[model samples]
Target: MNLTQKAMLGVSAVAMATALAGCGQTTTYPRTAPPTDSQCRDWEWDSKNGVYRCDDSSSSYYRNYYYGNSYYSSRSALQKSSSYSAYKSSITSKTSSGFGKGSSIGGG
Candidate 1:
């Protein structure tokens, strides 16, 4: 290829790399489990205080903050949590639950 074509190819490659780099970043958040303690051996979340229980060590310094890897310790905990129950009730309580229902406009 000629000089101009080579330059264009290089520019395209850089642009594609930059876009991919931006898209590759994953969300992160503080560990759901509590910090380590003198007697703790495993992460034991203390949902009530928004902290991990002092008796357990955290799994990691940070966790992937995404839908599939939720901070919850287990499925049972997630299902039993008030937020889960509330969300579940909201969807099942209504005949037209979940997206597709046009939003309502209000003037009050």
Candidate 2:
């Protein structure tokens, strides 16, 4: 190719590389969704605190709780309360008992 054509190709390649690199390094935030009934069923529940106890077998910081049925990782009282409220709200909304015609006492 001629000099001008070669130079244009080089610039275009660099621009494309930079754009791809930026996309590769983009940060992603962790997303939490309301837990499903099936997920919660197997979970050991802490009635007093209303937190599900699950084994964090994959986490080095949480491996200690994995034995003999996992317990909810301990959290500050405020955090636990907030989590409990969010869990309750999600369940209430999804279950027929909350606002639908189904009996309020039964599970969704």
Top candidate by lDDT: 1
- Model 1, span 33-65: residue lDDT tens: 444343345544533323343333353423211
Query: Candidates' TM-scores?
Result: 0.27, 0.25
Q: Residue-wise lDDT of candidate 2 within 1-108, one digit each (tens)?
A: 999999999987776555444432322222343234332333343443444444344444331211123333454542445454575566544532322222332312
- Clash pairs, candidate 2, are none
Angstrom error at residue 105, model 1: 33
TM value for model 2: 0.25
Model 1: residue 14 alpha-carbon error in angstroms? 3.0
Candidate 1 has an lDDT of: 0.42
